[model samples]
Target: MSSAEVVLDLVRSRPPTLGEGRLLCIDGPAGSGKTTLASQVASAGGDAVVVHMDDLYEGWGGLAEVGAQLGTLLLPLAVGSSGSYRRWDWRLDGWAETVTIAPSSLLVLEGVGSGVSLFAALTTVLAWVEVPPELRLERGVARDGPGVAEHWAQWTHDEQAVFVRERTRERADVVLDGRVP
Candidate 1:
């Protein structure tokens, strides 16, 4: 089977911490394919709710805050309640939108901090996707354009610190080479 199909099966087999919906996290450094992998998995698993950590982040320096917000807002979803969070508007430099997620058969949280320890107990599977730094940086610059180059550098530095401290990959239930097909 294809990689997505295999992952889909694996996610389906895991038990949900909440009512009946499995909580899956696809986490990795920026441009490491966490979002792509999460999308593939979500597409394969019908009726899945996908939450992008990018939206939850307050800004380039908001990883810790995002994790805390998720802990406060999303953790309760384990008991079957709707959850919402204000999304940061990169253009306006402030919170400009509210996003809500409903309970589902599967929920995919995708982004750098998606595998944080705060959600470990509630997560059914924390999948770490890894790509070489050079490739990841290339992808990030290409995606965000040259104007955000400095921001990407700072983000990379902050991500390394957080990853080392959180041991996100070490805590992962599955590791995916995001470069692979």
Candidate 2:
């Protein structure tokens, strides 16, 4: 079975952990294919809704504050209510419009910091994607542009710190190879 199929099967086998919603957190370092995995899972699970962690971040240095932001977005959902969060406008360097997410069969939260311990109890599945540091950096810069390499450097450092403290990978239900197509 494809990875997405495996994840969807796992999710379908579990009872809802977030009220009536199944929470699937796809988390890993930048450019580690979390987004791709999320897309696949969301497509496989017809009732899935996805919230990208990139939208919650204030800026390149916003990683540290994401857990609180996640709380704001997830707390209401835990009670079967709609949840909302202000999206960070990267180009404008400010908070943009709020995005609301209603509880669903599967709610996929994808990107760095999406699987922090703070929400483990509410999460039905936590998937960690990983590739080597060199490849991750290469993919990140290629997508974000070479000009942002310095920012990527700092981001790598900050994300590593958060990952170490959270022990996120160790806590995941599945660890995926991001190098897979």
The model with the greatest TM-score is 2
Deviation from truth (RMSD, Å), model 1:
1.3
lDDT against true structure, model 2: 0.90
Local lDDT at 179 for model 2: 82
Pairs in steric clash, model 1: none
What Cα-based lDDT does every candidate model obtain? 0.82, 0.90
Name model 1 segments beyond 4 Å from true.
none
* lDDT of candidate model 1 versus the reference: 0.82
